[model samples]
Target: MTLPTSDTRVETTVTEPGQRLLTVDGLTVSVGGLTLLDGVGLTIDAGETLGLIGETGSGKSLTSRAIIGLLPTAMDVTGSIVWRGQELLAASPAQRRRLRGTEISMIFQDPMSSLNPTMRIGRQVGEVLRRRGVPSVEVQRRVIEMLEHVGIPDPERRIGNYPHEFSGGMRQRAMIAMAMIAGPSLVLADEPTTALDVTVQARVLEMLRQVRAEQGSAMLFVSHDLRVISHVADRVSVMYAGSIMEQGPTVEVLRRPAHPYTKALVASVPAVRTRTAIADPLPGAPATPADRPTGCPFRTRCALAHDRCVEERPVLRIVGTDRLAACHVAEEVSR
Candidate 1:
């Protein structure tokens, strides 16, 4: 791996599918002495999907932003973010710019704000290709093909439409088209379906699944909805107070959570086939990184908290086969 630092630089290389695409280790982000993300680690293989699930302010979006180099200049970031074999933490602005849109793409939650209100959808989607020196005629053809692949109706007619002219779902499809136009190796989707209704949400999710299948691209899917994560993710990471509480195979972790926080989150999801009572809300306000406690970040809301939890922070450890949790009592409580 090439470790680029302030005084060193390296050339970027193309990575193939079925190989490690992104590796984040001990990623920490802070601004004005307030920590937003602490020691967060994640890995995504080419063509694999990793779901990041947490409540609002759990650092899920922050993690994605940090990876994509979208964080504010005031924020202090330290840690290793390796894409393919290149370290990104110390990479130059031009290096990151070269990677964005072509090697990596992001689909924001609100398409209305993310899409250019003044620009036509076709022009916006094809801009990346044109910037990379693709011929105008070929760019137009590829843009139309991508728009149709993402389920946009009447691509020929809608090509001239502006952001405001499309419906919520249609606008999101356009966003996906833009993100996929360059055939990025990694896609960061931060709650892309959160703003749509149930029917439209399902359709959009299906479209993403199809697109990933065809493109064979890795994805870091961030969302607060466990139901959505279950449908789309192969592995899942549970985040809280800027720390990862637990992570493992999606079905295994949900069925038998090892950490207290993961247990509470899984319990909160409603059952469909059987009649079940609503779970009681977790007591206390969600923890914030600015005022987080000394030890385990989830201890404030964890029923299993003890003196050990209060005095010493727990790092991620093996709780089961291919599973890891950051709780001292993980073995005792793991089901």
Candidate 2:
């Protein structure tokens, strides 16, 4: 699908009357009786970026998939996904189809797979424009312009190239261009730069931030890298065992984490200039949803674990101004 050239400058503010763009409330996903996401909730306001950060099995990607209605049919999903005050989970397939691309778009983790292998890069991008009823000639012109906007050199010449023709970094940039070309109200980026080199990753992150800002788009940026989240997101949610352990402003949560799991994650990030020895890695493997502990899922790996943590699950509680943490000892941890 290709976006129309004339529609390139269309900027839509998607906030509800309360200024909330999207809200996931009490969302749960279970596959074959094994839960993948358990009562996860988060929100993104108009033109704001919310970072979903956690280790590989923490249900970060699952949460994103649920929002976009991309989860497998076999998965048993329960909960509400509201976008602009509309319940998305209850929306018909046709409605979701219409909402996708024009209202919401996703930059998938793997650019190679997300893009059509047989289609030329230009056509694939133009397809989005075409879906919006763009004329063929205009699609081609805007495709090249978008390619150039993403920093692809000599886009007019490379427009005919296939996905394999572009380098890894370029492919990622192309994915970004495709996602943002339509000026979606919300953009969900699922670890879009995971496969790129650090230099390329930085560039892609910068491009994502710049394009989203220019388009006035709200973004849900999913990543396992706290460093990346710190650079791109205004606020962040830390997930563990399919639940949000802590959430607050990115700077506050990164600097003074109120949850034990969040603290461990911060400690694990390597310091660039300091000569300090490597910190002790978090103990124990991440728990699968099916095998989660009786009470706090992170209790098994947390040093602050006590009888209370084993007997009762901690609900998200106010820990500071605009901060929430699901830890029994959040006060002690923050101190």
Q: What is the C-alpha lDDT profile of model 1 across 13-88, one tens digit per residue?
A: 4456689999999999989889999999999998788999988999999999899999999999999999878999
Question: Which lDDT tens digits does candidate 2 get at residues 155-234?
Answer: 99999899999987789888887887778888999998877888767767777776555556788999988778888999
* lDDT measured at residue 131 in model 2 versus the true structure, 0 to 100: 76
Cα deviation of 288, candidate 2, in Å? 0.5
| C-alpha lDDT of all candidate models, in order | 0.84, 0.84
Model 2 worst lDDT run, 10 consecutive residues:
1-10
How far in Å is the alpha carbon of 21 misplaced in model 1?
0.8
**Candidate 2 C-alpha error for residue 141, in Å:** 1.3
TM-score of 1: 0.92
Q: Which residue ranges in model 2 land beyond 4 Å of their true spot?
A: 1-7, 10-18, 272-277
| Per-residue lDDT of 125 in model 2 | 76
After TM-score superposition, what is the CA distance of residue 238 in candidate 1 from its true location, in Å?
A: 0.7
